[model samples]
Target: MSEGLEESHQLFGRVAEEYDAARPRYPEALYVALEEQSGMRLAGARVVDVGAGTGISTRGLLDRGARVAAVDRSDRMLSRLRARTACGALLADGNDLPFRDGAADLVTYAQSWHWLDPALSVAEAVRVTGPEGAVAAWWNTVDAGKADWLAAYQVRLAESCSGYVGPALPGWSMPPIAGVMAAAGLAVRETWIGWTRSVRLDDFLTDLRSRSYVARLNGHEVEELVNRERAEIGRVFADGRLTVPMRVYLATGRKSRPGGG
Candidate 1:
């Protein structure tokens, strides 16, 4: 769709298992914002979940009773969603959605929109969503302050690890997001809340290695970089587990009403 997505998808494929294990789900407060402002009801409504990686966000929406068509370029990610209890999987991209105009009540992209070009994706999202529909995108950022040790570990991961920098910190580094949704003729709003998860060092490092930036590295170099991260993890989290702090940023926008766009 945009940027080095094929490579990113391949990288995700390589560590789908670890990605599933380490990635945290969206916070409930963010979901509450979606339910209130997204213009689509969560229960029993049809939703198209773009880049439904590991079914993480899909599961949340499903729990709200939304019937989700989980779509992603990564077969491994889609496979993960397929194995889940609820989800209809589709292999697709955000720039060229397969669904027809006005097909879905909600169109959502979670934690994967930056891998795509925003202008093109917003247009495509508007094209496929119903006039009354809404577009929602969210990213989970490592909060890095729930505990002292975890914050130090994140610094090591971002500074010393080869693959984890961009993926781990895109939430921190992306350009202005407030008006990105406005391009698609949708009004935008955003909110943030913190979350935490307990994860093993190896699983976390594998997930880091699954990033496109990491996969771009030579094998030995990638291993070496992650090894440094692992050593830091050991120094910081000698107990074999760490409570990872995360911040969920929820962005919601609604499709232009009939004849409005």
Candidate 2:
């Protein structure tokens, strides 16, 4: 990871509790989509969840009967994940997994792929999974275009947060997932699933504060931003409840069997 990216990971570790509480969980539809796209059943599948922060995705996988191993470079984040889930937590990076070849049925990155170098991480994921195994990477992002209030929030974020860039915040752009996976000899497919969540205004604000971009700000700056957001969002959500529009971007890359089927 680059210096800035490494620093952001450490910041996430420092606020692991807040992140676990505030970050949104992936919708169940996402897992169904993963199963359909990867042609892999979740029941009893061995999964390596790379960048498994706070066990959000890891827990989802476990609920579906997958035996998952949560891997992350942040010890604090892993500690929180371990406390919350039954999965084994490993302190490791995505580019270099400790597992032997074909050890896992699937390798997944949940909202954490951006932190990895795709060229190296993609290769590692392919190497770690068995024949016909798959690799999946996904992110849950705000669909600002779906709601006027969300659009305005994005504008405010761009104006106030130095790290903000469109809806992908923190990261300036989406990764070239298809190209990298194709280069690694995997068949890749992309899926976008739209979902919504209703949250209290305070909880929504807390989620914003937990974002790497906002969390990296100094205390005064973060407080100022949160205060402004409270007033602005309060005007829109008089009942103190917010309906957050979200979209899940998922890319599944499946390995071919020996016969290339």
Candidate 3:
């Protein structure tokens, strides 16, 4: 891994608890869409959830009846995952999985794919899953266009946060996921799911702080940023409540079965 990426991973390890408590869960519809696009049911499927930080996605997969192995490089993150879910939590890296060939019926990355090297991780995902098995990845991004306050928030983040790269807001650039999956000999499909959440301003700020970029800042810097954000948001929401819009970008790729279409 690159030095910067390694630093980011270490930062996430330090804030695992904050991340688990504040991050928003994926919409139920995203899982439904995953099954539809992948042509595979989660019920009873053997799944390897790569980059399974804090088991947020693992719990969801488990709820859908998937037998999931939650894998991450950070023991701190995996510790949180193990504490909350009964799934097998493994200390592993996505770029180099420790599973045997065809060991999984499906492999998934939720909100964590961006941290990995797709060229290596995509191939590893394909190698571990059986023929016709699927690999799915998704990210929940803020729909800044849906609200004026959110748009201003993005602008503020862009100006003040050194680690921020604008991923939380709409129109941010993403890696070429479809291209990488196709190169790995899998058929790829993509979809977007839009949703909204009503959260207390304090809780929303907590969620914002959990963002990898924001979490990496020093304590005083983070506090200053949060205070400024609170004030700006308060101006828009005097009641200290916010209706945050979200968009889930999902991509599912299925390996072709031998002697089948």
Candidate 4:
């Protein structure tokens, strides 16, 4: 891994607690999207979650009855994962995966795709997913509405993460997922899902701190950012709770058959 990406991964490790508190899990709608696109049920599939930080994604698979093996480079994050979910957690890097060829029926990278060395990760994913299985990737970006305050918060989020990166790296500025899947010998396909979540202003602020961008801040900057966000929240909500919106995108593809690209 390159220095920047490696650095970003380490940053996430240091902030695992904040991460667990702040990051939002994929809505059940996400599972439906993957299930629909892959045409594979999770009950008996061997699912591999690459960059499975804190097992937020891994748990999603576990809930669906997947036999999950979650791989992450950070032991700190994986430890939290172990305590929270029954899925198998491996301390490993995405670039050099450990599973055997055709070992998995479904391989997923949920919200963590940006932290990977795409070219190598794609090759690794291809090698692990069985010939007729699927590779599904997902991410959650801030919703623009349902709360006047959250839209304002998005501005701050953009500032915090704007050139910021995590230990594995800055994740992808523009994720080359479909292309990577293609290069890895998969035919590309995708689905989109959108929804809103209700959260307190404090919870929303906690969510921001979970991002690598804000997580990398120094004491003063971090305080200032949180205070600024709180001020905005104060203006918008009297009871301290607010409804925030979200958009989720899921992309999936079948592993290339041996004789085809």
Candidate 5:
């Protein structure tokens, strides 16, 4: 990966607490879809969640009775994960996971794959996953161009931040995953699940701070942007809260089984 991309992954550590407090959680429907795709029930699956910052995704797997190992490169982020959950937290890179070959029934990357080189990360995933086991990656994006206020706020951010494409916002498309999985010798499947979350205005603002683009801002710029954004949000949402419509795009594929299909 480029230095800037690597730096963006590390940037979350600076606001680890806020990230844990504000980043959206994965909907249970998405997890169910993943389980279906992998043909592995969550209740007994041995899962490794790579780039599992702050235990958000790890906790979800654990909640469904999976035994999960949460892996991340940032000690600060891992510390937050450990504080919130009992899952094993491994400080490691996605490209170089510390797992025995074929040790995991399923390996996952949630909202973190952009930090990795897909070639290396997918290879590592394939190595750690048992025959017929799966690798899944997903991101929580806006469901549609439904939140105009949020759209305007993102525009403000784009205007302020250099070369910011706002991938976290609505309308930013992911590259084709079929070719990516094919290169790893896996058959890919894709799914989408829609969900909604409502948050207080302050929490909504803090969530923006967790983005690499926004986190790149200087303090003065952030404060000014927050003030402007808060007003825009207020104009659209009454009662000091906002409802966010979100869609999770899940791409999953299984490792080739021995004596393959």
Candidate 6:
């Protein structure tokens, strides 16, 4: 990985606890769409969740009856994951998994794929997944530009954090998923699931702090950004709470055979 990306990957460890608490969970509809798009049921599946973070995606897969092996590069993040579930945990990078050939029924990256080198990670995903097995990558992207307050907050984030490249505001456009999956010789189906969460002002502020880009800032910068954002949020949500909508985009594909099936 490049130095910037490596640094970015390690940044989440600083706030793993806050991230686990504030990050949004994938909705049931997303799981349903994954099943439909990948032709793989979560029940009785052996899933390897790459870059599982603090087990947000791992716990969700486990709850749906899939035996999940959670893998991430951050030990602190994995520690938080282990605290929540007894599922197998490995400190590994998405580009280099420890699993053997065809050992996994499904491989998933939830809100973690952006941190990886897509081509290498997808290749590793194919190497570990069984023939015709499903590889699913999804992200919970905030619809930040939908509201004026949120849009202004994004501006503040960009100004405060130099590395604040986003999930594409306004429409929340997804990354180039089809191209990367195709490079891995997989046929992909894309699906989108929309959901909303109502959070108090404090929790919402914490969510901002948990962002990888925001977490990379110095402590003083984070404090100043949060204070400014809090004032803007107060103006937007008079009752000190508001509903934040998110769109979960799932790109699920099947691993191709060696001879090009």
Residue-by-residue lDDT tens digits, candidate 1, 9-60: 7767877887787666677787788887775569988888888878988899
RMSD of 6: 2.7
What are the lDDT figures for the candidates, one per model? Answer: 0.76, 0.88, 0.87, 0.78, 0.83, 0.83
Screening candidate 1 with a backbone cut-off below 3 angstroms (N, C-alpha, C), the clashing residue pairs are: 143-245
User: How close is every model to the real structure, measured as TM-score?
Assistant: 0.85, 0.95, 0.94, 0.89, 0.93, 0.92
Error of 1 at 203 (Å): 3.1
Model 6 Cα lDDT, one tens digit per residue, 89-187: 999888889999899999999987877887888888888888779789998877775666666677777777877766433454677767789777788
Question: Model 4 scores what on Cα lDDT?
Answer: 0.78
Count backbone overlaps in model 1: 1
TM match of model 1 to true structure: 0.85
The top-ranked prediction according to lDDT is 2
Candidate 5 residue lDDT tens string, 42-74: 998999999999988999999999999999998
Which 10-residue span in candidate 5 carries the lowest summed lDDT? 163-172
Report the alpha-carbon TM-score of model 5 versus the true structure. Answer: 0.93
The residue-level lDDT of candidate 3 at 13 comes to 89
Tell me the TM-score of model 3.
0.94
Q: Give the Cα error of residue 24 in candidate 3, in Å.
A: 0.1
After best superposition, candidate 6 residue 22: deviation in angstroms?
1.3
Q: Write the per-residue lDDT of candidate 2 for residues 1-261, one digit (tens) a residue.
A: 463654646978877888888889999999999999888999999999999989999999999999999999888888888887997899988889999999999999998887888799989999999987999999998898799989889888888877675663545555677788888988889989999988998888888888887877889999999999999999998999999899999999999733476
Cα displacement (Å) at residue 170, model 4: 17
Q: Candidate 1: list runs displaced more than 4 Å.
A: 1-6, 145-151, 161-172, 175-177, 256-261
The global Cα lDDT (0 to 1) of model 3 is: 0.87
Give residue 3's lDDT in candidate 1 (0 to 100).
Answer: 40
lDDT of 3 by residue, 1-261 (tens): 353644646878888888888888899999999999888899999999999999899999999999999999888888989887998888978989999999999999998777888699999999999987999999888888788788889889987876676655456665568888988889889999999988899888888888877877789999999999999999999999888998999998998743477
